[model samples]
Target chain A: MKVRVGEIDLHVQRLSPDAERAPVVVLVHGMLYDSLASYYFTLGPAFAAAGLDVIMYDLRGHGRSSRPTTGYRLEEHIDDLVGLLDALEIDEPVHLVGNSYGGSIAFGLAAAQPERVASVVAIEAEPPVEAWSQRLGDGLARAKPWLITDEAIDLIKQAKGDHEARLSRGAGKLLQTTTIAEDVLLSRTIDPGLADIRCPVLALYGDESVLMEQVDYLKANLIGCRVVVLPEQGHSVLIERTAETSSLVLDWVREQSLVEAE
Target chain B: MSVDVQTTEAGVLEDLTGMLRVLLEEYGLEDAEITMATKFHEDLELESIDLVTLSGLLREHYGDRINFATFIADKELDEIIALTVGELVIFVVEALR
Candidate 1:
């Protein structure tokens, strides 16, 4: 189902959508190539099985959510999440499980509206810092040559390559027609004052991941923060170590829920 | 839960196939082929995200009766990467039963 959030309808898939008082676990996916699928393919069902109401949505301009010509700002993403929670009538704090860029958005919401966030489990996180924003801008600028190039599109937009074709086209249009890069460049980087976030923040990093510093930055700045590093993993720990990722996230959420109950 | 003998395996296969076809087409994979033995990654060339789209389709049609995520929970990441369409067919058939 969809929850209309300002400019577009956000596609939401809820496990136990009708559970009025169940502990809510909201999932946020990374940008462009990533979507709710990362969580759905992994921890979503497990969260539901553990009796935590699981909520997953495609970020705007990704997955099945509306692909607007603009509005991909960091603040816009935060608004989308808050608006979605309000639309669902979830007044209480909800556990936020975020992967990569999603972690940044989760932090955006937590910093902007800490009351709505119960706890955060950020994996291979690229914190919303000026450095990461520059990285995103540089990465997208670098990827433009291959991602939406005419030859590349022709090669992937074939009968046997529909999956790649769909993703490419969506991403191509997004980059070609929108101001996402500009938005990212202009949006406020996560501030040092976020140390006031009252929720427990669990930061996990792959030992081989480039975002280790980002995780460390959060640890340095945020309160109630804990860090876990997987020895043999990398940025894609979500997929590289799927079971461990989901189990750890579930365990964290479970423990946090019990803490809240007390 | 006791299996209902009335729901034939072939009948479930048909149901699942139709649902999968709709999803593939919706995702613009209209010409992409599918069979009972089709491996999700190899045959359909599905990315992790594609399985997510398929999972939603299955949920809409089968509801709580077929929990695709739980069906996947038992397998490790590599095992899930190597799963075949027939495995899902059998799981759905048994679950519906």
Candidate 2:
């Protein structure tokens, strides 16, 4: 269903367990992807089976959320998430799970307003703006062939090891129409900002992934941080190692005991 | 939990530098270029994100006992800017020890 979050209209899917509870877990998707499509491919029922209510949604300009001509800022993304929860009237703080760019947004929200988050789990996401831009620039310079393609995208999904569903034409449309902001990529570094976080964080990365190869630096900067590496995988650890990733995440969520009803 | 500045440990810097160089080499950078002075952002053009990503590698080889937060705030950005191979070696050795 759609809910109004500030000026944007967000598309969300709330999967409640057979029983209702408190502190629902919200699954926020990354750039050019929708929550239902992406989260289902990686982690969904794992949390549900653990007795937590799951809420998934597309951020503005991705999936089913409202797409503004501008305002694709990371802050906008965070606001959208906040607005979604507020609109849904879920009173308790949420256990947020973010993937890729969504992970960065989750950190942004937690850093800016700690009271709103019960905990956070960030997957192979880039840190923040200055760092992200520098990395992108370096990647453009050192890495060959900068263009993103359908096949490359497919390969990325495969590398993540998706079994939920192959990328449909509709999914491509969902990705293509959304706009990503460069300003958002220039503003925050997750490490420097992480000091403000009081919640527990489980930061996961693929052992062989070049994008998040700097695990030690992240661990160094984040307070109360835990790291997990999936061997023989890359940036797409969620897909490449779905069962293991799901198991680890579900176990973490179970321990947190965050479930809610609207 | 913070970076120590008063130590004069021998070969510590070189050893740390050697380990970093090996990791950098995996990314196709030259051993000569991956020095301690290699500023993760400027000289190497490593984005802050790269620094975040790179930290994982250190944890993998070094183990989790190392304090990541202390290591970051201890040094000057300029010192880490285009870190020299020698400087990086010293930084890691001291931080790890």
Candidate 3:
């Protein structure tokens, strides 16, 4: 469904169990080539089947969502989430499950509006800390030249496949045509305010992933944060380790709900 | 095969083909040939995201009778990647039963 959330219309999908008043869990996908489909095919149905009201939406400029040429800042993404919750009239605090860049937005929302988030499960993600901003900026800067070139895209098509090449092409377009790269770099860093997010957080990372570097930082900063490292896994934990990731997420949400009930 | 089974399979295939055509319109491949042998990822060159949209169309048409998620849940990633139009048509037909 195309939902009017503030200025843009976001493509949102909801999968709920037969029961009413189930805890809401919003699944936020990664950036660029990623969309709500990542969760739709993996976690969305699983969570819904487990009795959680699962909500998945395409971020602006991704998937079926409205693609404005601007407004891709971190806070703007947070604002989108806030507006979406209001538009949906969901008053209760909802759990947040974010992957990659989506996790940064989830953390930003939790810090910005602590009352709205019940718990957060971040998979291969970090909050928009100074380090994160710097890393993302450098990464995007390095990728820009390679991504924007037709030669590179064609090479990718030959080396990878049509599907991968298509994804790269979309990502290249997003980077070239929008202010996303610059806007994301200008995102307000929540480094100092990390302690303000009082809600429980479950940070999942592949043991071999470079993202594990942020796990200690998260544990040291957030009051109720728990870290889990999946051995023999890499950055693509959600896709590569779907069953394990699913079980871990379900267990974490279940635990959080049990804590809430007490 | 029985006449009834053939008709039902053909009906499901036609419905899926229509959905695929609509989905392919964005890529200017609306007129692309769609058959039971067509592989979603390979022949259609559909990203995983396209499957999400297809699932939505399936829901709108079949309602609660066909659960696309459960149908694919048991399959491995490779199986899903190599999925054929015929497999989905069969699932939808059996589900509608």
Point to the candidate with the largest TM-score: 3
How many clashes (backbone N, Cα, C below 3 Å) per candidate?
A: 0, 42, 0
Chain B alone, candidate 1, TM-score of: 0.78
Give one digit per residue, the lDDT tens place, for model 1 in A148-241: 7777777887753655575676677677777776678877776555654667888889998877776667777775588889997878888778
Give the interface RMSD values of the models in order: 2.8, 15.8, 1.6
* lDDT of each residue in A70-165, candidate 2, tens digit only: 676677777778888889887677888888778878877888778888878888875554666566545433322322455655675567433212
Give a tens-digit lDDT track for model 3, residues B24-93: 9989988778999999989997777788789888878877677889987876655777799999999998
TM-score, per-candidate, Cα-based: 0.85, 0.60, 0.94
Who wins the lDDT comparison?
3
Q: What is the per-residue lDDT of model 1 for residues B20-75, given as tens digits with 9 covering 90 to 100?
A: 67767775876776677888776766666667767777766777687788888766
Q: Best-fitting candidate, measured by DockQ?
A: 3
lDDT of 3 at A28: 93
Q: Ten-residue segment with the worst summed lDDT in candidate 1 chain B?
A: B1-10
CA deviation > 4 Å runs, candidate 3: B1-7
Ordering by lDDT: 3, 1, 2
Give chain A TM for each model in order: 0.89, 0.79, 0.96
Against the native complex, each candidate's DockQ, computed on alpha carbons, is 0.43, 0.01, 0.55
| Comparison by lDDT, 1 against 3, better one | 3
TM-score of 3: 0.94
